[model samples]
Target chain A: MLLIPCPYCGLRDESEFVYGGPARALPDMDAQTPEAQHSLYRPINPRGPLRELWYHSGGCECWITLTRNTITHEFEDDLS
Target chain B: MGYSALSLMGHAFRGNTQWPTLIAAPDMRTIYDIVIIGGGGHGLATAHYLAKIYGLTNIAVCEAGWIGGGNTARNTTIVRSDYLLNGSFALKHFALKLWEDLTQDLDFNIMYEPRGYIDLAHSDGELEQFELRANAMRLRGADAQILDRSALKARIPLLSLDMDKRFPVSGALFQPAGGVVRHDAVAWGFARKASQAGIHIFQNCPVTGFDISDGVLQGVQTAKGHITCKQALISVAGESSAVAGLAGINLPLNSINVQACVTEPVKPALDAVVNYNVGLSYLSQTAKGEFVLGGATDGYASFARRGSFERIEDVLARAVQMFPFLSRLRLMRHWSGTADITADGNAIVGQTPVSGLMINSGWGYAGFKATPAVGHQLAELLATGILPDLIAPFALDRFALGAEQDDAGIGPYPWLH
Candidate 1:
C-alpha cells in the first residue's frame, strides 16, 4: 500500500486519497491548437520521476503535489 | 532430432542425452537486411514470419534478457476476440485463427486450448453494452453471444448468481472460441523455428542507441557491438518510449505495472475463463489446476515490474466476492509486468517520422493475444513498405489527426485505458 503524505494532513493510506493523474499545467483554452489540446488531454506517460496531484478525499479533502519516481515508487512530499 | 514417439523411445534407450537444442546461439553479424528489437513473443514471432513467409533470412532479434523473460512469460494468457472496436477485433480474431494452427505450423507444442471465455455483467446497462459488443464481434466473423443468468449458471456451476446479493451476476458475454495458451511456449516455439530458419537469436544484448543520419536510420548500437541494418523494427512493449528516444522520437506511450497472481494447485473446478468486468478482475484455471488471476493496471503510472499491495487486495476482494470458494486457496505467487499503454486504448503500429524505422508497441495488457497477428502484419509492412489495411487504423499519425481509437471510452488516459 502507498503511504501518501498529504500536505494538509499527515501520512495516510493510499485508499484514503484519490489519484489525480500527472500534475500538468493547463494550456490556454482560448488558443486551442492541436498541440495545446493534446497537452490538456493526453499524457506523455513518463517512465522516470513524475510530478502528480493527489486529492486527500478521505480526510482533509485538499489537493497536494507529489514528486515521485514512476519506476521506483519513491516519493518526496512537496508542501510548497 | 525431431520430437516423435520414435525419437523419445531412442532417447529413453540412450539415457535421454541426445536431445537437440531448442534454439541456436549465434554471434551477431555486422549487418543484416532487417533488425528486430526485443526477443519476446512478438519479436520472435515477427522473425519467424519474416523468415518463413517473407523469405527474409538476414534478420536478427536482439533482446535485453533471455527469450520470454518479459511480459510474454508474465501475462495471464487469456485469448479472446470479443472487442467492440474494428481494428482490435480484426487483429485479435486473425491472431486466434493463427493460434489455431500455431503448433502445427511451428512444429512445437504451444498448449493452445479453446475451452471458452465468459465476461460477467453486473447491471442492465452493462449487459446492453455486452450485447452491443457481441453484435460488433459477430459482424467481424468472431464468435460471441449473450448468455442469460440461468445459462451462465449452467455453464459454470460454481459462479455465484444470487440475484439478492450485492453485485449480482445478471448475465455474461460468452465467446465459445476464446481460450488460453502456454505463454512461454509461444515464445520458445517461435524462437526455435526462427532459429532453425537461420535467424540470429541474440540474448542478453540490449540496444543502447540508434545510428541515424539526416532523418534516416542506419543501424543500432548494442552492448555487444554496433550492427548495421537496412531497416529496424522496434517491438519493445514497455520500453517503447525509452528505445524510441534513442532515435530522437517521442511516442504517446506510458509504461505502467499490471499484476497477476496464481493460487496453489487444486482440483480442476473451473473450465471456462471468468472475467468480472465491473471489478476488472479475470480468473482461469490453468492446465496445472492452479487458478491464474489478473486485475486492473495500477492507477499511477509506473515502469516498475511490480504491483502495489492495495491493488492486490482489491483483486482479492473481488475474486472472493465472485467465487466464494477461492477465499480458502492461498496465493502461491504474485508478479507484475510493465505494459506500454497508449492514450487511445489501442496499439500503435507502423512507421514513425524517421525513415526506415517502424514500431509495433503500446499494446498495454492486450499484446499476448495479438502476438501472431502483430508478427504477420509487421512482416508485411517491413517487406512491402506499405501499411496493410488490417493495421492502418493503428498508425502513429492517428493521434495527431484526432482519429484516436478509444474503444474503452476512457479517453486519453493511459492508466485508465
Candidate 2:
C-alpha cells in the first residue's frame, strides 16, 4: 500500500488520502501585478521537488498541501 | 440511434455477432462505412445521431441478438440528470431533457413519468453531502432541491422518520428531472428511426473478427460474410473488453456483473427513488407497481455474468430496511447484466489507440440515462474524426495524460464507485 504524508491530516496511509498528484500553485489574491504574479503561478511539470495536494477524505476532512520529492515520496513539510 | 434488441426481435433470445455468421447473409450488397456492434440503446442511439444529426448514413448496426437484449432491457430504469460534477452537464441534462421529450419525439409511449428522484440522508454528514450535491446541481442549471427532514417527511409520509427506527430516512435531495421510463420503448423508437434513416440493422450477425490492416480498420469478418468498413464503434457495455480484444485493441475495462431484481406487484408506495451511498442500493417502483431494485456488486471483476441468490436476498433486505412493507412483497424476478467497470466509474468515449476504432463503453451502470448525450457526442466524433470536448476526458489516454477526473463526488453507487 502507498503511504502518503498529508499536509493537513499529517502522515497517513495512502488509502486515507485521495491521490491528488502535484499541487497546482494558485496566485495570491492580492498580487501586485497580474503578469508578474502569474510567473510564480505558472504550472510546473517538474521532475524534482513537487508540491502535491491531497484530500484527507478517509481520515480528516481537509485538503492537504505538501512539497515532496516526486521520485522518493520524501516530503519536506506537511501543511494540513 | 435507437437500438432495442427487445423490440427488434420481439424480445427473443439474444444472438452473437460472431465473425463467421456475418459473411453468409444473402443481403451482402450493402457495405457500410461504419459498423457498430451491439444493437442496444447505445448502438441505436449512435445510429440515430449518425444519420439524423450528422447526416452520415453509411452506418451498420450488426447485432447477434435483438436490440436492447443487453443491459438496455435489464437496467433499473431510473433516469436522473442531477450530478455532483460540472463535466456531466451535457449527458445528464441533455439525456434528461430527451427523456422528458422522448414520448413526443418518438410518437411512442415510453411511459416516462416525471415523478423525480430523491437521495435519502440518514446522518448529518449525509445531509451536508446531499446539500452540496443539490447545490452543485443547482449551480449547473439543473432543477434540484434539498429537502429537510420535515419537508421530506411531508413529501413521503410513509418514510421512516423516527430517530430510533432502522435506517431512518431523515432528509432527501429531490431532483425533479429524475424519473423512470419504459426502457424497451427507448430501444424501439431508436431502432425504428434508425431503420428509416437507411441504417442496416443486421440481426443474428456477430462481429467476431475485425479486419485491421496497417493498424487501421479494413472491415469486419462475421460468420455469414465480411463487411468492409472504414470505421467501427464498439458500444457493447458488458462485452466491451472482448470486443476490443477481437480488434487487437486494448481497453481499460474491468468487467463485472451487476444485478437488479424486481418485487411482486403492489400499489405504488414510493413516489420517487430513494438510495444511500453506504449500501449502494437503489429501489424504485415501476409503473406496473413492481419494485425494481439494484444492489451492490456481489463479486469482483470476472467474465461470468450470473446472478446469485445471495445478492437477490441482499437487495431485498436493503429494500425491506428502507420500507419494511416490502418484506411482504415476493421477489418476482431478478436479472444480472455486465458492467464494463472503469477505474473512475465513468465511460471511456472517443478515439482509442486504434486508428479507426472509437469506444463508448465503460459506462459502469449509468448508460441508460446518458444514452442520448453519449450518442450525440460519439456520432459527432465519428463524423468529424475528432473527440468532442464533452466526453474527451473519458478517454483511456487521460490516465497517461495525468488529467484524469479521479474525483466524481457521488459517494459509492454500484460497481467501481
TM-score of chain B of each: 0.98, 0.89
Error of 2 at B47 (Å): 0.2
What's the lDDT for all of these models? 0.89, 0.72
What TM-score, to 2 decimals, does candidate 2 have? 0.76
Give the best candidate by TM-score: 1
DockQ of predicted candidate 1: 0.62
lDDT by residue for model 2 (B192-268), tens: 77777778787777888988878888888875588888888988887787788888766656566688888888887
Per-prediction TM-score: 0.97, 0.76
Clashing pairs in 1: none
The per-model DockQ list reads 0.62, 0.02
Clashes of each: 0, 38
- Model 1 DockQ class: medium
- Candidate 2, superposed: residue stretches over 4 Å from native: A1-80, B1-26, B407-416
Q: How many clashes does the backbone of model 1 have?
A: 0
The 10-residue segment with the lowest total lDDT in model 1 chain B: B1-10
